[model samples]
Target: MTAGHCSDSGPFNSDGSVSFFHLPWGGIVGRRLIGPMARPDMSVADMGFISKRNPDIGVIPSIRNTDDQEFPELIIYGTLDSDTVGSTVCKSGYTTHVTCGEILAFGVTVTFLNGMEFNGLIKATHMSCGGDSGAPVFQFAEDILPGIFITGMVTGGSEEQGVCVIEPIAKLITDDIYVLTINDPI
Candidate 1:
């Protein structure tokens, strides 16, 4: 689960191969997971996946929350019902770390300066940097569950305006690729 534009930028090889590192400086690497209709060379849908790298590295189903001393990493239970316009959402990226904001709108279509249009995007007021393309967009749900819900992934954003665009995770879930969750629904 990464933005298609991320592959267009970096983090992935030319053949759609990607490796996930456990730490920011790369401690443990994760296996390459395949995605559906991934834009390897383009950023049309802003969704992409990396091919197989090392199958030995272990991966976990969690979201980063450095502010929480009790629970540094939040477990990913599942997604909630449908997010509304006023729903509070947060994004986690290495550049910005974690920024929280409300959803402005959904089903948006943004066109970049290079004339590439990406549809099915959710617009939010959170901040993101250039290299934060594949960041995770999620919402913490303590009432329904103690963990966070993996909502979507960051695609593009306006650094000046302090806003970001995300693509819903539901669109990326296929028979093969999926988010590892307990209550995962197909």
Candidate 2:
């Protein structure tokens, strides 16, 4: 998934556009964007879909740790209830890589420089950066699975200390869209 703010930036350059990159065997494979789901203000729903995928490449359903080399085999089997708050959340992104922090508050409002404001966000300690806007947020537990997907992306926050503002996954689901689990077939 990608940030709504990033998706709102374009309709592509006629030739379409390279959306994501996959690095395997030290080589890069670029994926293209099929479409995006952006809110008018680009605050709550910040995600996009990639249209391209290489059959030869393996897609792991896991979040990579900061080390960038390890896949903990994490599976998002479930999500925390909405009223649940003040738990620890972790995320992996392009800029800061991987980091974990505590949830400081919920149902908060964050405003961007573009004059777009997002409400009902999860506020947490620092664990993200500028380029990490579309990173997934999860909760790590002692269970066999490494983590549980809790939110969609790291929408905003301080990159210096790692404070993060997240777009909760619950808020993203609708009558037509929902989160899928590993048990679901690809």
Candidate 3:
């Protein structure tokens, strides 16, 4: 129920230093060409056909606090343009770095700075343990951007799937939160 930006998707130390999501292969990216497709749902689970983008090096987008300092605001987006609606989409986390494994996920609508609203979702996969929060959730595809959208952060999980929630990129950026676009430094 707290509100803050993510730090990264690695682990924290009692001392300092950090471990981040090293996307040597980079993450995925998605963009809206003619705006979102008419059948947004049709593109479900078909991230490979979308686009791809990578996360910046050494910097993992997260929502953690360090030494009493909160990082900048950040959000991830897919290729679905304004025409698309944010509903019933799948997201992939770090631990289970698999293809099309995320289901039954939805994002919350947050208002942006331009008075726009965005829909984001919380990950249902228990992929993140203790050190895997802030791991970006994206889709990879050919002829498309690599990093589509950063689904959510690891808010914590239960016996079921790992409990991770994400704030929509549209919301963070529009709201004037220090946001880091995909492929940007963490």
Question: What TM-score number comes out for model 2?
Answer: 0.74
**Across residues 1-186, which tens digit of lDDT does each residue of candidate 2 receive?**
566676555555455543445432223455432333433334345555554454565545566563644553467665554345567777777666777778888888877777777788888888755677878787765665465755656888875645788888787666976556666666
Candidate 3 residue-wise lDDT, 1-186, digit = tens: 112212222143343322222332134543212111111121111111111223222334432212223322223433331113333323333444332324335554434233434345444444443333333444333343332444433333343434444443333233433335554654
Better of 2 and 3 by lDDT: 2
Clashing residue pairs for model 2: 125-163, 126-162, 126-163, 127-162
For all candidates in order, the CA lDDT equals 0.68, 0.65, 0.33
Reference-based TM-score of each model: 0.77, 0.74, 0.34
lDDT by residue for model 1 over 1-186, one digit each (tens)? 566555444455555454444345222454233333234545446666654344554457777767657767777886653469988887777776777878898889889876788787788885654567788778888785447887888887897877888877776666887787755442
Residue pairs clashing in model 1 are 4-46, 4-47, 16-51, 17-51
Per-model clash counts, in order, read 4, 4, 42
TM-score for candidate 1, residues paired by index: 0.77
By TM-score, the candidates rank as 1, 2, 3
**Model 2 lDDT vs. the true structure?**
0.65
Each prediction's RMSD to truth = 4.4, 4.0, 15.9
- Evaluate model 1: give its lDDT: 0.68
Q: Rate residue 81 of model 1 by lDDT.
A: 35
